[model samples]
Target: MTSTKDEISLAGRREWLGLAILALPALLASLELTVTHLALPSIAADLRPSGSELLWIVDIYAFLLAGSLVTMGALGDRIGRRRLLLGGAALYGVASVLAAYSVSPAMLIGTRALMGLAGSTLMPSVVALVASMFKDTRQRGVAIGIVVASVSGGTAIGPLVGGWLLDNFWWGSVFLAGVPVMAALLVAGPRLLPEYRAPGSKRLDPVSALLSMAAILPVVYGLKQIAADGFAWRWTGAIAVGLVLGAVFLRRQRRLADPMVDLALFASRVFSASAIALALAIFVLWGVNYAIAQFLQLAHGLDPLTAGLWTAPSAAGTIAGSLLAPRLAHRFPPGGVIAAGLVLAVAGFAVLTQVGPLGLLVTGSIVISAGLAPTMALATNLMIGAAPAERAGGAAAISATAPQLGGALGIALLGSLITAVYRDQFGHDAELTREALGSAAGADAFTTGFQVSAGVSAVLLLVTAAGAARFLPR
Candidate 1:
């Protein structure tokens, strides 16, 4: 039988070492997400990809990663978490090497897809392993904080790292950077991490897994299309079809004796609330952060390296907030702490609305990162903690999935909004500005759109803050 939280001992040196191993994959997954954006121009120039092919090269990784997460998590639970993690790490390293050496866009896209599939296995397994290793409430909180910090920190620093790499070496160097990290994880994981498979877990269901992928891929693809090309009937239809399939998938889960996803877990208010809060927090962070990155470059006329350097402080703030969350939770209620953080994020968004000066933009981003990191860390802990040990992998997948969907939606919807507003500012040259923000006659139109987006983000965060205060457990 699994030990109750009360019966579990505090984590020791071995567990701490294991956590460091697990964090490598977590950090790598996030780094891969953001790092590739910087390399896109280089890839385009070298591979001579058409616009459509280039989009696929940039997006296919996330599409496969998000679509496959739930299935990979369940697979980890049925197999051994350690076994799955190490296997995935090996695959990731091989895929990264393949991606680096690819001569054609098709080859690069295929390798990136492989990397995404391998990435799907890493996060849920890492979170499940961390939960298993650090069973004590307080210790678990800190461990989760560290894991969350790694992800957020990696995202914040991705541009800086990618810029430096692109400056010194070929674009392929970015993909190669992950190879060593995965190698380290593969070497140490078997020795440091414990093996865990859910005891008496049911056989894996192929149909459910298919349904999950079918439901997720279309929706995510549709969102990405909207973000890139603006709204279209085809994309809306894709989302509608995915929603229908998702409903069907849920119905099947309700009837199955050994369902892939445990519906009962969502019955807990804690699980449901944490999931919602985490999603909303990511929604604002990613949507606003995306705009801010563009603002630093297109509006302010800074080069990639300079812009990355300007954004570095936000990365530091994210790490600080993530690490500080557990310590703060000891003194205040978790719900209160979360609400407070959201309020602070709203303030940051408010600052962003002014849309003047580089220092102001940097300050706003730093404040926003500082505020949202705590909410992400604490909510992740609550979501994963609410699950039974055997279901931790699935729980972790769900936790991870929500943020992916949220970030995608934020980028799509907010990006569309920004483009629309910017186009509105230019009557005769709308097409020109819509095609390239930097090529616009002036930065004033883009600035206006950014300000509007920030205001909308602030209002959404304020509402989320109120909900967190009222609903989440103290």
Candidate 2:
């Protein structure tokens, strides 16, 4: 039943070039995510933001981005993907410039929020466009791998790039760093990226858009709160309200003639399994990376730039794994490949439990990165591939949203666990060392927490590997 066109790759030199152009937004978005971590201290020093305002400055962008993705994805399907992408790129460029010049905490927060909304358009469009361009399965897998690598590469280099900028220039320069990238994307995007709009797609439903945002924003905000301040009734209540709203959103979708999100896509085991696997992979990766970054800076007493350099190997490992995944899939079944990678991740997490030496920590991280990269790439490929072409934008949005939610949950739950362990282990001196991890007791307690969290992560990955093998299609 398969057509010859499905088997043959239609992508030519131009398509390859277009793929590169599409990757820029994904790379920039991820870079923006981590770049601000280093810039926060500089921002605090210059802007003198209140504690609440600083949190908003840091959190608002991600909150808005996550909440907006599903609506934007559906919007791309109704409008043209390339059109949405180019428009978003222009907005992102303007917002970046505004962010750089902001004189007050409130101004910076508003600009960051705009950047987040602009960013929501990029990932789904990029993925859906790539899917449309690469008709052949193998080529599509390879192309998505490259895109995934770009994301990982951006996250890895963000702090290093931000550190170098901070060393030479003011804090605002970090925000400006994205301007040129967006400018280039704006200039090159229309020429290279092909337009894709689903035929007969209805007008976007404003009510559905509002419901999606209302459901997602509260949940994301709650998770971020849990990460920062541990569990409280206010945070848990927000999560519960979001869940109720989410159920209402789903019920509304089932009744709509043309749903914003196609409820049928989740019926496919391949789609659902791939999505869950992808989320789990990111959950562990982001959670552990959070702890590791602090470990390098607070425990080992390294500068941001130096610590970033040390983390480069892990990025290289991820790049290598992503590039190699499609080739491996050609030889073995995709599910098996994913399972094998997760097993390798288990070994990597095992190594982390014994991270007494700096080398061991770095090695474990690299191994973990290498192990998870394939899951990210191939699971994404499987998830997108499972969707009908008409629904590719929504599918890509779901793909984008899962990792964001997972990363948030991982940071909240795992970060909270680590803090709880540290406090418990610190015993009577916990209050004394609360502000900084300067004391020997504080350092030792953190290390213990790190080890315990790694051990827990290892078990979770092991179970996930089994699920991937059993549930994911061969």
Candidate 3:
């Protein structure tokens, strides 16, 4: 007969396998998915897809992912995370090939949307699997750190990987980046990863699934369009329709026995407050990164490769902060750590706005990232920790929604702010072509845009900080 300690050790090894399977795809998916943002000009020059088509190609993945995560995650509970993870991995690889060899922009964009569906299937399922696999809260906390690290820091790796491929090969090579990692995971996954099915899950609820998609797609699409096309009446109409649908969807979720997202979890003051802070942190996270990247490439004349290198400090800071989060949480409450992170992130943004030096921005970015980094792990853990084990997926579904909304809104709000500023400042400079305005509107317009975006990001950070302090438990 086996000793209790031996059984425990075997169980521990089995639990770790889930995180291993998760980390590779989570990292590659995030990195490859967004890495192409910088290569838009190159894509336009080669494939010549129209403006709207290009935006669709850029946004359709996020649109689909954000819309479908809750539904897919619920499905995973009914089926099994391990089985679906392997299936989703296969789908991701197939879609990557399609994206790499697309004959038309529409084909490429559609494939990307499918890839997003595959991603949503995989993301929450991985987290759910981790929770189920690791019976130990401490181990799961560390596992959560790994997940947050992949989500937060993956984009940092994105530029370097995408930049290198753009520098040497072709634009499509960015999609190819995920291929090798997927292949390795597929080979190792079956042997290493244990299969997981919820012990007492019911059949997936169709009504809840349909309402979720209906509610999220319109809002995300409208926000994205607003970012690219400005504040048009059509976009406003879509937003209004979406919000109404969302209200209806929420009512339905509250009444459901098995909701895709648990609406009731917001009752926890700590959970609600942390979610607020987490959402706002994401707003600054993407906004400043987007603004700063364009600024460095356009104003400083760095190649995509070198420009990516300059971002290393910020990435490192984010990863470091994520790693330190659990330890900090042990010493202080989740609220304190989150508020502290927001302060650092705000101070970092302040430094970036006033300072023009590249080295300084990098240093500030790193410092700021360190602060905001731990918030994700702590927030995610807190949300999941309080959830009924059966509703872990639902809690995650709710948690994930805020950040995706924040990201889309962040991009749109910041994009609108910068575009409005850029237009007001340079719209009358009759000689500057749209392309030239984007490319060579000189250092001042670019700096002004960067400063404005940074300032707004700072304000959001402060708001998140205050929200955390006022409401969250000490």
State TM-scores per candidate. 0.91, 0.90, 0.90
Candidate 3 lDDT, 335-422, residue by residue in tens = 8888888898889988888858888889778877888887777877777777777676666656666665565556556755665565
RMSD of 1: 3.1
**Best lDDT among the predictions, by candidate number:** 2
Alpha-carbon local distance difference test for all models: 0.80, 0.82, 0.73
Q: After superposing candidate 2, which stretches have Cα over 4 Å from the reference? A: 1-9, 48-56, 223-231, 419-442
Candidate 3 segments exceeding 4 Å error: 1-11, 224-231, 428-443
Q: Model 1, range 1-474, lDDT digits (tens) per residue?
A: 656646657788999999988888878866776667657656766887765576577557766776788788788888888998899999999999999999998999999999988988888788888877887888989998898888876776777897798888998998988998899998999899999887777788999999988997788777656655667999999999999999999999999987888888899888998889898898887777667666766677665567668776777778889999999989998889999999999899899999688888889988898889888889988988788866676787788777766765675567557766766676634445534443324578778889998999999989888988988878
Cα lDDT tens digits for candidate 2, 14-124: 999999998888788668866775566567668877645765776677667777887888898888999999999889989999999999999999999999899888888
The alpha-carbon lDDT assigned to residue 410 of candidate 3 equals 66
Order of quality (TM-score): 1, 2, 3
TM-score of candidate 1 on Cα atoms, chains taken together: 0.91
Scanning candidate 3 in windows of ten residues, the lowest lDDT window is: 428-437
Models, CA RMSD each: 3.1, 3.0, 3.2
